[model samples]
Structure formats: C-alpha cells, structure tokens
Target: MGQVERAALETITPYKVEVVQGNFVSKDQIDQLRAGMSRQQVREILGTPLLTDVFHAQRWDYVFTIERQPLAPQRRRMTVFFDDDRFTRLEGDAMPSEQEFVAGLSKPRRNPRQVPLQASEEQLLAAQRDPTEAPPSTRTAPDPAPTRYPPLEP
Candidate 1:
C-alpha cells in the first residue's frame, strides 16, 4: 500500500479493547471477617473465594482487579488464614466502604443550560396524554364471555 493509504488505514483502525480481570469483594464483608471465626462463617460472610487450592485448603484468597481505558486501574486482594479450621487473620489492600463504592459510581449532576424556543404548555400537555386513546379500529371486538363448560354428566 502507498504511504497515504497506510496512514489513512492506521488512523481509521479501531482502538484496542480494555482489559478487565479478577474477582471483586466488598470491604464491608472483609471487615466483618474477624479472627477465630469458623470456615463456614467466613464463607457465609465473604462468599466463595476466587482461589482455593488443595495444597492450601486452610487459606482462602479473594482477589479483585479492574482495568479500563482512560481510567486508572484498580487491584485488591484479601487473604484469610486458618489454623485448625478457624480464621486466624486477614491481609490485603485497603478498600473503600460500601457507601463510598456506591458514591464513586454516581455521575455528577449539573444545571442544564437554558435555550431559546422552549416547548409551550400546550405541546407538553398533548405529549403527556396517553397514546393508547387512538381512533377506533374496524376490527371486531373479542368475546368477553366463555363458551366452554365442564361435563354435565360426570
């Protein structure tokens, strides 16, 4: 291909896909998991872990990672250690609380800019009226009464 054609193709080519990988766990649940808790209790609070190996049956790992374009990536891991079937301790990165997590996802609200030629009251009323109230159709109406009945001679 010529230089001009090559340049055009390169410019038009689509951007690469964002890579997002790993398990996600909330900080609230992690905080609830304390030392001396049974394996079952920890599981109930944190759900099944992402990694569980036969060699490390006593240790459960919860790993979460996310990556996207034009935004900083996030990664977190929570490890729960067990000694003789009871939780010993947890070690991982600090995480946001449930409220903070939710707040982060919300979009900022801004006052809408005023524009000329706003819709008149009449137009708004007309739009609000139900569209189902259209002109009557020529099609015949369905029978509201039922004709089927149980056998008289049982």
Candidate 2:
C-alpha cells in the first residue's frame, strides 16, 4: 500500500468491544470446593456450569473467554467431576485469583493530567475589575399602559 493509504488505515482503525463470556471461576471459589460437597454446594460456590452433557452427567464444565482488541483472546476451562452426585475432583487450567483477574482486565492510565480544584490568586484578581471604577449605568424604558378586558359573564 501507498504511504497515504497506510496512514489513513492507521488513523481509522475500527473499534472492537471487549467480550466476556461464560462462567468466571476464581481461585478462591475453587479453593472452597471439597471432595464430598453436594452439587448444590458446588453451584453456590462456582455458579452455574457453562456446559453439561447428558452423556457426561457426572462432569460439569466451566468455561470463560474474553476477546479484546490489541490483545490476544484468553480462554480458560475447568471441569468438576462427580460420582453418585457427590463432588470428587476437578481438572483444568490454573485459575487466577479474584484480585489478579480484576487487575488484568484493565491497565492504569499513564500520566493522568491533574486538575486544580481552586483558582489561583492571579486568576481571581484578573476576574475582578478596579474597585475605583464605576459600574456600568442601567437604562429602564417606561412600561406601557395596561389594557382592560371585558368580563366573560357579562
């Protein structure tokens, strides 16, 4: 592409919204899981599972995915295994702590400009006019005579 075309393309990139989907299971929530916990207890801790198959009723899958521009997409999955409707074990990718997950979602802005809450003395003085100067004269016009209207009942 020509230099002008490249420049135009660079200046007019499309905006892509950040998309977060599926269950987000934090490390803390996973830590709460126990080998003998019931399905209800597990649900209360980790929320609803993203995928569950009838053929594999003993397994519950939690998947999380985030797609954001300028950064590579991220996806994580965790599976909870159960026997006789009792929690047995879990297998999946290493999960991030709640703090780390939240922190990773956004980056702090660099060098934010500080705004002054109060005006400086120079600005205050500049806004005020000389005390000795007379204020501008105000002119008032005479009011027109009021009109009389007939009574509606008459």
Q: Pick the candidate with the highest lDDT.
A: 2
The residue pairs in collision within model 2 are: none
| Model 1 alpha-carbon miss at residue 136, Å | 29
lDDT of each: 0.77, 0.88
- Per-residue lDDT of model 2, residues 48-118, tens digit only: 99999899999999999998766668899999999999999999999999898877777445446699889
Summing lDDT over every window of 10 consecutive residues in candidate 2, give the lowest-scoring window. Answer: 133-142
Least lDDT summed over 10 consecutive residues: which range in candidate 1? 104-113
Q: How many clashes (backbone atoms < 3 Å, residues ≥3 apart in a chain or on different chains) does model 2 have?
A: 0
Runs in model 2 lying further than 4 Å from the true structure: 1-12, 108-154
lDDT of 1 by residue, 53-132 (tens): 79988899888776654356677888889999999998888878878765654534444457877889888877886666
Candidate 1 has a TM-score of 0.55
